[model samples]
Target: SIDRKVGSQLMPDTSPGVSRSSQLDSETHPHVDDTPSSNEHHRPTPLPAQLQGRATNKTFQSMTYVPGLTPKIAGILQSKVPEGTVITSTMSRSPPPPNERSSVVYRLGCKGCEAKYIGATVQKTEKRFSKHRSDVRNGILATALSRHTLSSTGNHEFDFEDFDIIGTEKVRKKLMLLEAALIKQERNRINIQEEFAAIDNCYNNLLLNLNNH
Candidate 1:
């Protein structure tokens, strides 16, 4: 009882789960369909090379034709952004040399006259100008600018350069109150009238208008 047709559909030759030598091997296999015939298509998916390959019937609704999905999203944003990474906004910095500063408030003229000397130091104004040239080389007037540089006689002097910060304060009582407001805004100051008479001229006109700017 074996026969096969399939044109009007009816191929049995051995039903109950076929096996009569595999239904006589279906006369050497013929009717094989897993659903596709109706003109069987599906071979279109090409247009890609940066869309410069022009051919737009607009299909997949636009992912620029998906392959490598936008270069795998730009290679995952260039491996999470970091190639010579530089983004500054307003980069500029430079100012730190005056003898490595430090809570100072200095000034010390007198290369022979107009004698000024306001001072202060938490150290490192070149180590407080080397302790005022070691208290005028060991005559130790112990300050008041070493007793006006060892007793002011016309044309006084004092050396060892680099002085004149005039202000800075990491607070040592606001750096000697900015060295008593710059020795109460000097005027040929040699700093020692009880150190500008212990400050109190009702802010001597705001310290002489901050020493005229």
Candidate 2:
């Protein structure tokens, strides 16, 4: 009988025939993620921080979007004059009567333009003219005139042939009315213009940045 011993028993194959990679289920395979990770939650983002701190100035560039003057704004208009009654004590028992005159002077100043007008006012000088400035700045030129005559006092007193001494209040009203009329008559003659619209647009953009923030 021939000796028939195998040189070494072949090791029994323990591994499956399929590769380890192929053993993994397709659904369980690791996915390549492009999204931000949870660790990045605290990272400095590009959006909110980028848009902050814009439009923080109050210069001409910041005044855009100021609403145009409407009747509602007029109601809010305030007088520059202090509200009170004036009392004067005179040497004589009978107090001297108040002086009334025609033609008040209005000093209207803009960024570069300055206008002088002689008109009448029934109120204090400073208070009445403030309205003129407001109206002029708002493009309501019907309130600023070239020649306004009102009840003058002290150094401001001046006489006009057509005008008479009305009470201060009457003078104020007359001055305002005359100024308004002159502004209307010369509305075409007066070369009035403004850049508020443009300024407002720029400011509006600034405000938008604030809103977005």
Candidate 3:
């Protein structure tokens, strides 16, 4: 018969205010809730310095930001990218070293036009054709096709293999000079044929007019 408050709005404290007994369930239950609240302050979380931007979808939570790195570390990061990426930089560098002897197609022939061209590379082959296309389109190299040679054919069927690379600057210059020489030689041959035909036409015309006279 413990006297306690019990009404429509307020519930009775049936147990006689025991501090640590099963009878004191409401107070003990809320003390259990306090455990969770206490844990919130101690819960492990990634520090801001260790937080990384979301990679793909999963957040990277263990990386720290480093301000600067040695050249060796910089190189490691650069190499992580898959090959075929065009690398442009402000640093001036000499041309690549001499490569093994390889074949290069230097000419394309048609009834009215002949194009002399140098194309292809192999040391790192993945994006060589891409570079060639960019060069041709940008007018860095003379090209037989307005677009990439591969694109003009609409398939991989027109792709030609170039095994030869005049690797050093000197050799590259020499190959260029040789290409010019070959083009000049062809022009000379075409001129001779045109001149000989002209002469023959003149001679035949003269003979016909003379006979008529």
Largest lDDT belongs to which candidate? 1
Q: Write the per-residue lDDT of candidate 2 for residues 1-213, one digit (tens) a residue.
A: 123334233333348785554445433666745468998878876557655875433322111111122222233332332332223322355422222222432223222223233344555554555565455446563632411212222232122222222222234444454343333222122223221112224444433443343
Query: Candidate 3, residues 1-213: lDDT per residue as tens digits?
Result: 234433532654465755445545665575553235666789887757535663434322221111121233345545885432323232166533323323221332222233323332322433544555575556562343333333343332223253233121224444343333333333322222222232234444433343344
lDDT of 2: 0.35
Identify the runs in model 2 with alpha carbons over 4 angstroms from their true place: 1-115, 144-213
Q: How does candidate 3 score on lDDT? A: 0.36
lDDT score, candidate 3, position 94: 55
RMSD vs true structure, all candidates:
22.6, 21.0, 22.7
* Candidate whose TM-score is highest: 1
Write the residue-wise lDDT of candidate 1 on 128-199 in tens digits.
788788888798987788888778776467644746675666758656655776677677777776654545
Query: What lDDT does each candidate get?
Result: 0.63, 0.35, 0.36
Q: Which stretches of candidate 1 lie over 4 Å from their true place?
A: 1-109, 124-126, 130-171, 189-202, 206-213
Instruction: Provide TM-scores for the models.
Output: 0.22, 0.20, 0.21
Clashes of each: 0, 24, 3
Q: Among all windows of ten consecutive residues in candidate 1, which has the lowest summed lDDT?
A: 59-68
Winner on TM-score between 1 and 2 is 1
